[model samples]
Target: MKAKNGSMVAYDGEMAFKKLSGGGEGIRGMVTRRITGEQMTVMEVKGHGTCWFADRASEINLVGLQGDKLYVESSNFLAADAGLRTGTSFTGARGASQGNGLFTTTVEGHGQVAIMSDGPAVVLRVSAQYPLTVDPGAYVAHQGNLRQSFQSGVTFRTLLGEGGGEAFQIRFEGDGLVYVQPSERNTIAGDV
Candidate 1:
């Protein structure tokens, strides 16, 4: 399995941890990640009976992917099955607004992935009739076939500090599950 570097705290049986310079995506992926500023320090853990992983005592959520794609931020990523393919993808202005860079992490294949959040994550379902809007800072990860769009309610009123607290949000349509944390991170678009 691949986990965030230094996130392994305890394990039973035998385990070997090796630091991966660039998320174990190979030389080309390393260069691409470096140039895009979507860096992730990862480690490979093998021969583990029971491995415990944590990051700053953050809450963790388990997601099972059956040939689907999961889009998550590197900062919120904890671990994934070794068979899962990890890469980076463009997130456009959503990442810029959250101060998380222009690229997010992608995990695909039939395996389980672990994600972290400031608080317990709430899973919300989105469908053709039930689209959901999420605060960028509260979003953790999402899976299934979903279309994400960045929405900004910033207007002239925002200039005068009278904007809505949630002026920036990510709208999710199609069919999928969205993971959201109750707490919001300090983001550039938090107040407007």
Candidate 2:
């Protein structure tokens, strides 16, 4: 299993933690991760029987994937089953380098992934019948087949802080589940 460093709380059997590159791609990956502003600090848990993990006091959410890819921010990522594969991909203009990661960590294959959020995450379903739009700040992760498009509501009024408009929104079209947290602050989303 691969988990965020310092997330291990307890274990019942023999386990050893080995630090790994952001996506286990080694030193070059670290350089790329730094240049692209990805936060994927993690450790590998080997020979484990039972293990407990946590992101301090943050809430933990489990997502089950069956031969599907999960798009998630490294900040919210907690852990993943060893059978899963991890990688990074560029998410274009979701946040635009405003402190939110423009690249997200992806987990692929059949397994369960652990994610951390500010509070109990809310799950929203998006399908052909009904598409969903989300504020980037509250966005956490999305699973299944979905199309995301960047939409901007910024206007002259936005600069004056007097317009009834949102600066930006990510529209999800297709079938999928989106995980979001309750927040008043603006955040960013990864690529679909």
Candidate 3:
């Protein structure tokens, strides 16, 4: 119920647990409930959770996943959970609509899991005013309640360093918190 000295204390149905890893590093939370028969769960965190993030523009970080329906950029990516069926697909690459890497394990609702990144993380509350445009590579973890999609149709001007739109972007539009790493150039499982 309470965590001090950079630790996480979690309670699940009269069962309490603490996170051995300290906070201020990345997404820190606990599993609250498990979905009936899926490879996903509901996670809850104290304070705002974040991923390895940096504004440097060229830094990279390794990362890993622990849930289904994960959205990640092709570049700056290293590896994923061991249980995941590895595959690569571009923004509009053929068969991308299949949604392969998104979900890995089979968990149900109310279940909890952990997502890890290289360093510290930044939690953002997405909304219309400050709509979050996450670089696919920088995405780490998000709530199961959020919606994920792909956005395309960009003009040449946008690709000429215009900043409005470029090649393509994996879009997450909904009312849920997202974890992003500052280092958007690192692969999750690439050689460090």
lDDT of 1 by residue, 52-151 (tens): 9988999999999999999999999999999999999998888988889989999999999999998899999999999999999998888889999999
Count of backbone clashes, every candidate in sequence: 0, 2, 43
Best by TM-score: 1
Better of 1 and 3 by TM-score: 1
- In order of lDDT, best first, we have 1, 2, 3
- Compute the lDDT of residue 116 as modeled in candidate 1: 95
TM-score of 1: 0.97
Q: Model 2, range 145-165, lDDT digits (tens) per residue? A: 998888877678766866555
Instruction: Give each model's whole-structure lDDT.
Output: 0.93, 0.82, 0.38
| TM per prediction | 0.97, 0.89, 0.38
Among all windows of 10 consecutive residues in model 1, the one with the lowest summed lDDT is 183-192
TM-score of 3: 0.38
Candidate 3 C-alpha lDDT tens digits along 5-111: 22223323343323423121123221211111111211223343332222223334333334444433322222232234322222233113222233322212222
What's the true lDDT of residue 177 in model 2? Answer: 95
Name the regions of candidate 2 deviating beyond 4 angstroms.
26-31, 185-192
